[model samples]
Target: MDKTQNPNNNEMVIDLVDLAKALWRRAWAIVLVMVIFGGAAFGYARFLVTPLYQASAMMYVNNSSINVGSTQVDLNDLTAAQSLVETYIVILKTRGTLEQVIEEENLPYDYETLSGMIEAGAVNSTEVFEIQVTSADPEEAERIANCVAEILPDRIAEIVEGSSVKIVDYAIVPSQKSSPSISRYTLLGLLLGAVVSCGIIVLLYLFDDQIRDEEYVRQTFDLPLLAAIPDLTGKNSGSSYYYSKKTSGKEATP
Candidate 1:
């Protein structure tokens, strides 16, 4: 059996070099569009988005009080205390503790809302842990964090017998906002700008149909070369050039 048939691709050929050239020629326009989008995004994020502030209190778990005559906690005791960090967190999040915080602070938030604002996590998986409160008002965040710090140990002792923790650092009013980072927002805006600008350029390149020179005809139609025409002006710049009726006036002979 003869196997001389070559498979035909039948795919339309795209000139990436031409597309690249077209994009390069309109680089300034693309950059302008990108800047406009990026600036708008930055402005929206900076001015419109609500910023959140975080205040945290650092705590150290101390189980030594339960170990009579022990001056310092052992490694095993510390490991066991680390295990109780979650129990302490649970006690801190109880409806009773949260309701008390709201009552003492006279917060407008209810149990559920107040609970949602507080977060607890272990630091480096050791006995140390942090209680963070996030709120729109920085002072409120600090107050809530401190309130939790002051109340957590008592709550833990009530729930877990002979378990206690000490405050390493009290919550302080944060000077800066935790959320709505301007740099991150600006970066996202720039990425959006690049995508939008590049998309428009690609679309314009794909939709353009104007042909330039004999090369276009030969490649597009698979046609053989014919007799060439000579340019008298010797300034042929192809379809990319526009033949304008507006002409540069000749300088008067001095």
Candidate 2:
């Protein structure tokens, strides 16, 4: 048995050089298709999709007041507190909170639609949680974010104690818009499209049995290659005479 016949033999494996050569042969077509699709996706993401501005307020819960009777919270109590925080985050997003915000800010949209854009999440490794509000209007996002952050702790404190919970950090009005990350979104789309297009090109090349290489001609016809005739466009650039001579020789053969 031939040593090369073993599937484990590195010599029998597909080479990067061969794969690159195949890709280079079809580079122009790939570029043309990818450019077209990339431009289309970029335009749609930029111009067609609605822009959303986000404003977030961060807060840290220190758990400052410790009870002497029940001095330390057990694992179950900690889990339950985290669960309650998550629930309050949801409640902070409801119409009740939005209604207060809308009445205070005199917003144009109804509570239901306006509350849809708001999002909240706890920061990992710490008791810090963020209340983020998003909208087409920058001021609305800022207003909603500040209102939610203000009312949330007070409401939570009322359930837990007689006095207000201490606020570690106050919500500052954000000046920058957060959504439709143009550079990030565009770059991500370009990268994704490139990978998908490259995979498709590779698959097509693998499955295609078309005779496009000098090696294919030599193996199929059992002919010795004296010369290779490149694409007509490439030949016309500087090597017309050499390519014409090769074509003439092939034609002269009986």
Candidate 3:
């Protein structure tokens, strides 16, 4: 092979055919490891993590004039009201509001943890907003959602003057727990683990210098193989002249 114009260049290219061959050679090991790891992950996810119930409530910016005496609500004023509502949604999950929720609910968790559990966001391109609360206790999740829904407007009003946001829908007692998504996560883990296992196997196989196949021998050295010598074992003494004499105790086999 030339230094630049190599004769073996065509054989060194990587493609699907080469990948398929490598994976086929190592399929059993990949499948076994994927199954073991996938099962372990599924088991741990299903059994180890505590289940949490999520409760959500819908609220919207009322945008109605605080002064009933006013004749009309300005469009610009409504836009500003929506923006303010978004700000209040961010404020809803703050330590102050969360601390109040903790005190009102008598939750076992502290303020910091309770703050972490509350999630709030506005529905895009609309006045509607949602508040989600997660808890190990389903009723408590609902209670927290409803509590925030009921109390948040007043809290906002106290913080910002002339606000008119209201709850359109209250949180209902949730029927489903949200954690331990075993089916989806387990399948994902299996796919990732299998790919990684096969990748490592193929890489190691390619880097290894052991002569495992006729292709390896032919590629490493251009030569013609004519014959292979047989082992001079005593078991073949009847068919071989050298081992026959050793078996007859006349001489030792080479």
Candidate 4:
């Protein structure tokens, strides 16, 4: 076979051993890339990202009314209170309630900003609802939540005309941040780095055209028995020669 010709050049055959060897040769580069990306993600999550704290207060809707004659609580009033919990959640974030909270708390923020920070939701199917506030400052978050708790009950009483709202739990300053998960970001960085490194390795392997071993030569040319000439140079120098015989049994060395 001619030295320049290739027999197994169909482009569909894949040799896993060659692929593994190629990746092993560049293992250090892949590891370095992985470390760099993972460290960058950790640093960004730990130092660059702003952490927010959340504070929450719980309020209960009590629509129960006493019968003057019997002095017993009305069942229909209690059921009405349960249904009003959802309506109270909507009113809690309204401009009227939020502006009152901001004014009472002396917050240096507008109604929109205060409203954006406040979250109110009914607790399951019960007549209880929770109000939460998130801010960069823990104390501010707690203060805002508590102020909403204090003002919303009276506001609800005025709006519903005899319905009662009571505070069940007061907001406290949160000790821990609510977001910026370091471990999760680091793991994502690791996976991203590994995928990028593997892609680079694959690209390099596909683009490389140099044949590094005798097996590649034989596979490319579909050649029969042939002697190999080993290059001897530098400190590992030894010997280099080649011999081949023709059909006439005449031996030639070059």
Considering every candidate listed, which one attains the maximal TM-score? 1
Q: Which pairs of residues clash in candidate 3, taking residues 3 or more apart in a chain or in different chains? A: none
TM-score of each candidate?
Answer: 0.80, 0.59, 0.75, 0.70
Write model 4 residue lDDT over 79-128, tens digit each, in one string: 78788888888788788988888778889999888888888887886789
Tens-digit lDDT string for candidate 2 (1-254): 00111224423334467678778887777777667767777787789878777777876553434343785777754554455556667667766667877787777879777778777778783455777777777777777777777777766675555323334555555566666776766677677667777888788755654544554444333345555654467635433211112333552121
Task: Report residue 207 deviation for candidate 3 (angstroms).
Answer: 3.9
**Candidate 3's residue-wise lDDT over 1-254, tens digit each?**
11111235434433456567778888888999899878987887889978889999998876656345787767786677668767888778777887888888787888778888888887885677889998888999999999988888888877777665788899999898898688876897798779889879778755655433334333443333332335378675433222222233443222
lDDT of 1 by residue, 1-254 (tens): 11111225545556677677877888898788778877887898899999999999999887754476768767777778889888888888999999989988999999999999999999999889999999999999999999889987888887778778999999999999998888788777877887888888888766655545555544544444443444446576322321211134322110
lDDT, residue 124, candidate 2: 80
Error of 4 at 6 (Å): 12
> Which run of 10 residues does model 2 get worst, by summed lDDT?
1-10
Model 1 clash pairs are none
- Cα deviation at 61, candidate 4, in Å, is 2.7
Off by over 4 Å in 2: 1-19, 60-64, 67-84, 110-112, 162-164, 196-254
* Rank by lDDT (best first): 4, 1, 3, 2
Model 1 global lDDT (CA atoms, 0 to 1): 0.78
What C-alpha lDDT values do all the predictions have?
0.78, 0.62, 0.72, 0.78
lDDT of 2: 0.62
For lDDT, candidate 1 versus 3, the one ahead is 1
